[model samples]
Target: MIYDFILVGHGLAGGILARTLSEQGYKLAVFDTFKANSASRVAAGLINPLAGKRFAKSWLAEKLVPFAIAFYQQIEKEFNVKIWQPLPIFKFFSSVEEQNTWMGKSSNPAIQEFIKQVHLRLPFSESINQDFGAIEIAQSGYVDVNKFLDCLLVALAQSHLLIQEFFEFSRLNLNADFITYKQDNNTITARKIVFCEGFQAINNPYFSWLPFSLNKGEVLDIKVDNLPAECIYNKAVYVLPFGTDGFKVGATYNWREINEQPSAEALTELTERAGQILKKRFVVTKQAAGIRPAVKDRRPLMGWHPVHHQIGIFNGMGSKGVMMAPYLAHNFVANLQGAKLEPEADISRFLKYFTGI
Candidate 1:
């Protein structure tokens, strides 16, 4: 069957692109294996305006956060599911100096909206050891990514738009304007093909040459009584409440030995770190690992293939996929329709590598 687009991978990137394309009345099909450790499936889906050790505003935070909130809220309404949780992220300061730095940052008009207040001490929980107090961020929350993706998957299947199979690069045939995929007993042709394969793109013959410094991250699902369920608690790691009693504590970023397998060393590290902050006892119930599709410059990769104009990619969102995907996906859709995306995100920045110059 002829289609407008064929998307490879059904992670956050693929899912967002699919939603955008389908909303625009484009006939698109998705091919995915739904790997357990796929980046999107394993993400805690935190959408924070201020990030990193310095607690500076995230790149394009002003644009990405609002779009993400609206996008996820829209999806929630369409799917009739509770996915977007507009909660706050309470970042604990390790020292007085850091707390003072946050106080100064909160005064900036550009960042004031996101900073609810810088706390001198966490009033609710003595279990958390924030000597220098914490800063409660406004308009920050975690997305129920798994639930969101599951609902989308079902909806796509109901509409015959999802194919639960691994994409084979060898079976893909690209032309000047269209591409064809030869599967087991059927062939699907599309005007354009976009790869949103996450870290697996490193193995994709088409995009493998792109600079990808993938990192392995591990998280543990634990039940901690003292931690409040209302807001995300962040220190060395984040304690994101999943339900009334369960919290997701993560994550260890390992540059080497990157894989989906959860490691014992990481488990030990997390438990120890969590212990330092929590005065209450917690039990590790489950562990998960996934490779983040990060890049050297920490910007997303989007745009059509330099040589194969009909081929494109929407990936390299890294840990911020929860916030970045929706907005970037919208921009990507616009670019596909003859508009231009942000210069930094456009894959054309690396066109020199593709051109052998």
Candidate 2:
């Protein structure tokens, strides 16, 4: 085979998989059709140890967090670029009722080590609506996703390992030894073809029955010249800085699954939420909507196709792609190398009845 693996998409999942395999000395090629509103592209790339208004500990944070930090660091060293920045998330408190609830749950031990209650002013207090001050989430930050991908893309191009095209299903041909694709008017062979098509994979004929519900997400890119330059601001709506004089403010979820364009209503709603969080209004520079590849059970989809020996999938990280990709990719690669399945994220759990295991 000319390549040991052919990876589709350069989103979090595909990037993680390709990099991991390449580190193990596997020959690889990545094909990606750039879309403006792709989830990872629009994402604030926020990672928090605890989640929700009630502040519950994130699922598998102890394991996932360390793995993510180390993995991104390794990639950064290789590319000679800095992408992951660990900034505190200042979660401001609103109503008195909400403050009471938070105070009561502060000692739950679920988030004890990660949460720090604060009455002092954070840097955002100067430009934010920090009514009752806030608790700083020590283990929260945002990833510079676009920049990370940019560095990776350049590196891949230099290595002659990337392609940019909408991978067509019609070109996929499976044989005993390799999976081949008629790409860029040339025939290419790979030991295995892994699909990271994101939300579009719901329509893939082979794996359509996996039960995925796509959610359209709308996010805003607003320029705020007077805001704090350090740490992400997470109140009702998260405000993440994306370098330069801009901040990425998002996001409203519309579970209806229409992803044609950014809805005016959604844009208005996002702006309204931002106004509530920020002390002053900012310019809405850009608005976009992308359908998240959300799965029914809300876990990532990884591992081999049920019947196709050389075909596979690595997707469904959903809104948590930035936080989940490295950990899940490690598991998937281990499984592909004939190691035992890790208990949590194996795709076989979902296909148990279908596979009769």
Candidate 3:
């Protein structure tokens, strides 16, 4: 029996796509191996409207953040699970000049709604070094990715829509109408097979040529006493409140070290950075590393293969997956149903790469 779609990789992209398609009344199957080092597994799942050192609003943040909140809230109500933590993000200024820069940008119409408060003196004064103060951003929060994924997996399993296995590209056969995959003795056919593999896509023969700027990130879980638990703190690295008195400190970016193993050098670097910014004492509990599926142009990649019309790709979300996935997934499925997609996200933007310009 042929299905509407066969989704590969059950990370954020795959999960969202699967759910979006299923909700649209399409018969679909999802393939996932549940790798430990996948970006979604290690990501803090931050949804920040205003981000980065420049304190500029994220691309399409106004639309994406609200869509994500509504989407996750709907998921929570349907699944009876707790995963999203809606809270403000406290971005600290490195110097008075940086504070002035923030104040200048705060008046911009695009950024006004997300600015909850500007503090000359931070709320948490004792446990943090805030010489230049911090700004509390509204409509910012984090999604516990592990919990969210677990909830999705359980829902998919109950319906027998999830396949727990690795996808081998060698056994794939692409046809004009459908794509067939030979798994052991059984065969499965689908109208379209979408690859949602994260950084692993770097090795996918079908998508390997799509310029991917894979970056490795290291994060730490720590227990900090006397640290404020009300909001996410961003200085050198982000300090997110986790369990009781627990915080997640991260992350160090390394374009060279894309391996899964946590590096000692990264740990030291994070420790020093956290120490310089955090006045509270903390103990490291865990360390993790994951490779980000970033693109050279910093936009998501979505569209069919130039030659294989039956095969498609939806990836390259980078760090903004938490905020962008819901809206993008909705729009992606819309594109499949005859609506045009934004050119920035459409792989057609890079057709020159495949068409031999």
lDDT (0 to 1) per candidate? 0.87, 0.79, 0.86
* Model 2: residue 277 alpha-carbon error in angstroms: 1.4
Per-residue error for 64 in candidate 3, Å, reads 0.9
Model 2, stretches more than 4 Å misplaced? Answer: 118-126, 183-185, 352-357
Which of the two, 1 or 2, has more lDDT? Answer: 1
Q: What is the lDDT of residue 276 in candidate 3?
A: 73
- Sort every candidate by lDDT, greatest first: 1, 3, 2
Off by over 4 Å in 3: 355-357
- Evaluate residue 172 in candidate 3 and report its C-alpha lDDT on the 0 to 100 scale: 85
Question: Using alpha carbons, what is the TM-score of model 1?
Answer: 0.96
What are the clashing pairs of model 3? none
Q: What is the lDDT of candidate 2?
A: 0.79
RMSD of each: 1.6, 2.6, 1.6
Off by over 4 Å in 1: 355-357
lDDT for each residue of candidate 2 in 94-113, tens digit (9 for 90 to 100) = 86666777777777776777
What C-alpha root-mean-square deviation, in Å, does candidate 3 show against the real structure? Answer: 1.6
Candidate 1, position 114, lDDT: 88
lDDT of 3 by residue, 220-296 (tens): 99988777788898887888898676888888889997789999999999988888778878899999999899899
User: Going through the candidates in order, what is the number of backbone clashes in each?
Assistant: 0, 0, 0
